[model samples]
Target: MADTASQLMLGSGLTVVSHPLMYVKMLVQVGHEPLPPTLGRNLFGRQVYQLPGLFAYAKHIISIDGKMGLFKGLTPRLCAGAVGTVVHGKVLQCYQNQNQLEELGSDQKENSSSLDHVIKETTQEMVARSAATLITHPFHVITLRCMVQFIGRETKYNGVFGSIVTIYKEEGVLGFFAGLIPRLLGDIISLWICNTVAYFINTYALENGAVSEMKSYSQAVTGFLASMLTYPFVLVSNLMAVNNCGLAGGSLPYAPAYTSWTDCWRQLSLEGNTTRGNSLFFRKVPAGKSYVYAQKRFY
Candidate 1:
């Protein structure tokens, strides 16, 4: 009981610790929407490379108001974190109890193999996570909206209650569930990959005794691998969600509203291929880039 309580406390604390960093990440990821430079290039024969001026951008974001800006959308995140922790704990406890019952039952022991047991456990965890995600997804949307709501930026969403009300009025209930498909798919895949890799590493360490002091390093590496594998999907999903709200609030520079996931993919791919850069994302936006690339959509 004490150990369980300690684990819960640690998880809650870790969730809290992650918020400040998450806010910073959101700030950077959504803050800059580069416009194409005009008359400068024809280098690769297409528009590309719009720099946000890293030092200048940083300076702007770190000013007195900007420092506080780091915590812009923290309220809903903390609330969601608290609720999610409680739900996670309860779901885990339920699964543990069920497994214990299966272990104790003689007939069940004969019916299920180790593989079956593992599969069942994985399924249970995935379902639990999905449920929690659905319940808390609206909070996430609110968080993103609030985070991206800059001082001079035009946004209808304000405080938590105001945002909720605005979304309801403008977008209806479904607005809260924007990007549901990609978000769920990305989360499930990432969770599965992260846990599987972490499990293997942990088991190997326990068996071989090769890693002692480097456990934390090993875990960090595993986390990095998982994040890298899933980051593109997560990034796309977040942009989609942001765009959904943008559709409600009006035009946004980061991502215009996509009709569907396929449309989003098409737009991203076009940008990648048609743009002069080798990478999908351009650092500098040329003045003519938007007009040249986006003019077709106007029709």
Candidate 2:
């Protein structure tokens, strides 16, 4: 209980600090670029058209909605974080207890290899993560819609309960789970990739002495790589959450009404944008593609 409380407090603080970047990233993910690209030198010193970086994009938001605007949707995000942390802790504890009982009753516990133990732990964590995600996804949907409201200047999803009522009226219960499938797939795939790659590197590539020492950092390194690989799913999921949800940001010119998450993926792939919004800084427009600035706000 104490650990869970600590995690919730820490997570809330981090969420508050990171909400601005996330707000800009969500706009970028939904293909809403109100600002035009500027001439800038790339890492190699070659001139290129650079989209607004994090600070620049954030400044634009501030210009429109003031400093507090950067925190749009933060309340629901905090709620989601709290709920997810508690759910993950409870579910993981339950799984570990059940595993302990089974191990005490079996001979396999004495014979299980380190790799087997690692795999078992990873599996348990993945299950806990999936459960947390499933239970807290409604909060996620609310958070995304609340953030996207900046584009249309709409105030439909103001507070948590108000947002819930609005979603039920506009989209029914299914509204709470608009982008769930792709989000779940992304998380599960990323976990497996991270764990598998980390295991292989630690077991086969490193010396036994170094393997023990590197074990702590291997998962972090591999997790970054795994997130890069599965980022398209995340982009698709965010877009799906707001798409056709009666918001201008989800409509044509900003975004097309994706038939499904797969359709969103397909469209993004064709446009060479499966990894859009992956970077908060140093964004470069693809060659031959130029952004046309919107002359006025949607609402």
Task: Please give the clash total of every predicted structure, in order.
Answer: 13, 0
Candidate 2 structure quality by residue, lDDT tens digits, 16-100 = 9999999999998887877877789989999887888999989999998999999999999999999999999999999879988
Candidate 1 Cα RMSD after full superposition onto the native fold (Å): 6.8
Best by lDDT: 2
TM-score of each: 0.70, 0.94
Worst 10 residues of 1 by lDDT: 273-282
Q: How much lDDT does candidate 1 score?
A: 0.62
All candidates: CA RMSD (Å): 6.8, 2.3
Which candidate wins on TM-score? 2
Runs of candidate 1 exceeding 4 Å displacement = 1-17, 31-58, 64-66, 107-118, 198-220, 244-252, 273-299
